[model samples]
Target: PAVPAPPVPAPSDREGGRDDDTRDKLKQASAALDRRDFDLAERLANAVINSASPPKQRAAARLIHGQVQCIARNDQEAAQIDLRGLEGFRAMKQRLLNVCRKHGILGR
Candidate 1:
């Protein structure tokens, strides 16, 4: 009798799945932001934004990234950099807000 092999684990079951990694990265970014490490926070938040997660997670990641960008803008010594960062935050906020509104998650 031929025995069937065991089925492989789904993509979500892999170690550090997409959602888990995204959430972990978001936490790391938040910690970096709290420490005033704007550069590291931006990197980590961007990682979460670029992760292969669902729309809700992506929106959350964008919000975090926008926050980091806002912090960076406040610390910017150059006016050009500050303006650019502000623009980036506005765009990210708008995009995430649209997503949240569509999903009915914008209002409590």
Candidate 2:
């Protein structure tokens, strides 16, 4: 008896799967941040940034990246990220910048 070939995934399905993985990565990065595991968070954020994520997702990833930089006192790198109220993370960007300013890490 001939065995049937396995079904192939549709393009949308593949994209959806990728999206899901991105979401999972974001969640894990956020969790790592919460745990103060900056190394892990940075790695995950880098993965997201290097991926073909939508702008908003990329922004979120950048947010994570920026936070890690700030926590490590790498203000120069943090400020280089163009996180100015775009791509759906406006509040976080503003808040983070404000915190950086208060900490004297970010110059006004």
Candidate 3:
């Protein structure tokens, strides 16, 4: 008798479905920001920022990542200095602050 072929794995299983979900969530969060839904945007942004994934995808998450850090810095005293020390953060610190200010997520 011929040997049976190995079963193929599903795409979702192979990809873990997490990255796609994160991307979708990030897009929704960005849309919420565009719609001035700061509260929802903040929630979604936090989810993406806190996700256990590589920076490549998270960095592409953009506005959400910014909003999460902005909110964290404003609400968590301990995170302020560390968040400020992030790469390219110091140079664009003022600009980021300005954005957060406009979003009402952070105080100037």
- Best by the TM-score measure: 2
lDDT of 1 at 16: 55
Task: For candidate 1, write residues 8-98 as lDDT tens digits.
Answer: 9765666457678888887887788778897887788677656676665555555655554444553222322323333445665565445
Over 1-108, each residue of candidate 3 has an lDDT whose tens digit, in order, gives 999999996667636788778888888888987786767776776677678756644544444546555554444332344245344544345555566676565564
How many clashes does the backbone of model 1 have? 0
RMSD of every prediction: 9.8, 6.6, 6.2
Q: Flag the better candidate by lDDT, 1 or 3.
A: 3
Candidate 3: residue 67 Cα off by (Å): 3.8
TM-score of 2: 0.75
The TM-scores, one per candidate, come to 0.53, 0.75, 0.53
Report the backbone clash tally of model 2: 0
Q: Which stretches of candidate 1 lie over 4 Å from their true place?
A: 1-12, 74-108
- Candidate 2, residues 4-48: lDDT per residue as tens digits? 999996689789999999999999999999999999998998899
lDDT of 2 at 100: 60
- Better structure of 2 and 3 per lDDT: 2
Residue-level error in angstroms, candidate 1, position 102:
27
User: Lowest-lDDT window of 10 residues in candidate 3?
Assistant: 76-85
Number of the predicted model whose lDDT against the real structure is largest: 2
